[model samples]
Target: MAATPALEIAPEKVAHVIIKAREYGAKVGAWNASTEEGDADEDPSAILEDFASDPTLGEIAGFIDALNDDEQANLVALAWIGRGTFEPEEFDEAVDTARSEQGNSTASYLLGLPLLSDYLEEGLEKLGFSANDVESDVL
Candidate 1:
């Protein structure tokens, strides 16, 4: 006999997860810098790079990277919505709070959020999760 499986969740669901995670991170002040208003013409990657370089922020990014594909998606959303500077001390506290409240890392929390299928699919693939696996509970 064949085994039945849980239906794969939708890609939008995955995107939603990312959104939630970002918002949570933002509210907790998980920003990449100390200020929001920059040169206005500065490159975004530079900011991310800066964040990646900071000891605390870099640790956070590593944490973000550790999240499952679903978490990765939401981290993107969080970044989209919560762009700008963040106080590391405050952000650290928030990360702790987010963890207690969300029951997962900020990134993983967002992965369960809703988002466009195409984006979610691509995100999952990037995170090393099979898009098909996302469709079901195999993973």
Candidate 2:
């Protein structure tokens, strides 16, 4: 079947989000990979402290929080599309639902979802957009 038309949010805007989600995913992975044990010279609590204080995590959250309502809704819709909650043909309906359901705190909501980066990337693919350029640009 032919791919769905472009998103109201624009591929570039979605790509911007894809980049941030990727960075956020990497940080989360690193934090999870780190050992719980502390070095002889360091306090054990410091590990958790550093994880909590990670600037990259904060940047990701801040960037999402900075998005306007429409942008945030678009992100949610894209994720839903990627995650199979909606098909590509249902894109407009998905976006409409996202806008009505999102209310406030979209950043927190989106960040709370696991595999967010994967979902966003898949969503773009559903719309016939490749994430290769976005990934390269983010690197």
Candidate 3:
């Protein structure tokens, strides 16, 4: 099934976020596995230190912040659907709840989820939006 155009947040935008989240997860995994003795060419501590100052988290935060309140709420609702807290048919209710409970910082709230990428992807699928094209383009 095709994605409903009624969706407030575009599928393309969601795809972008998913890609960034995946990239961030990869960087985190690499940072976790790195060691001083691992690779001579790459400094583990330096890499980890660089990550601390990197704009990855900030970029995501900024992207999310740029969205309108309704868009942000929809994003959160989709994520909740993906996370299994709400079903696809309950999308409206999810969005309503997200809007009602929305805090000041949507970015902080979203970035805190470790499995954000997976959840977003799942949510998109449930919404009848396939991320395959977006994923390929990202690669």
Candidate 4:
């Protein structure tokens, strides 16, 4: 079997990102957009509504932005690996590509992926890390 790839980004950090990403991904776009306001008891679905000004988005983005450049690159590479763009053995290549191909903000680029949480989790698993275990610890 191929050797497990090492990760520059800590599993704990990645787990944190996964948790936040899951929260962000669970949001629905303005499901309660109608001006009709209702009591929480009447419309609990409001909690799932995602407004353009939602802080969750900013929170996750800021968390990702705080990481150094190498961490950001490794993050992108991990996502790529999870998404099947590269094999686990190609980790270094993936990281190198991530660095060279960086254009927009890493946070922006990553946040744009609807399946960011899944991809990251899968990437961690592929690298022989247990995302679930790390995530539980993070929580």
The residue ranges of model 4 lying beyond 4 angstroms of the native Cα positions read 34-41
Better of 2 and 3 by TM-score: 3
In model 2, what is the error at residue 117, expressed in angstroms? 0.2
TM-score of each: 0.23, 0.74, 0.80, 0.92
Error of 1 at 85 (Å): 35
In TM-score terms, candidate 2 sits at 0.74
| lDDT of candidates 1 onward, in order | 0.41, 0.73, 0.79, 0.89
Weakest 10 consecutive residues of candidate 2 by summed lDDT: 43-52
TM-score sort, best first: 4, 3, 2, 1
lDDT of candidate 4 over 39-110, digit per residue (tens): 457678877778766789999999999999989999999999999999999999999999999998999999
What tens-digit string does per-residue lDDT give for candidate 2 at 1-139? Answer: 5547556666666676677666666542223447553343654433333355466567777877877777778889999999999999988789889988876688788877888888999998878778776566656
Of 1 and 4, the candidate ahead on TM-score is 4
Could you say which candidate leads in lDDT?
A: 4
Off by over 4 Å in 1: 1-4, 15-34, 44-139
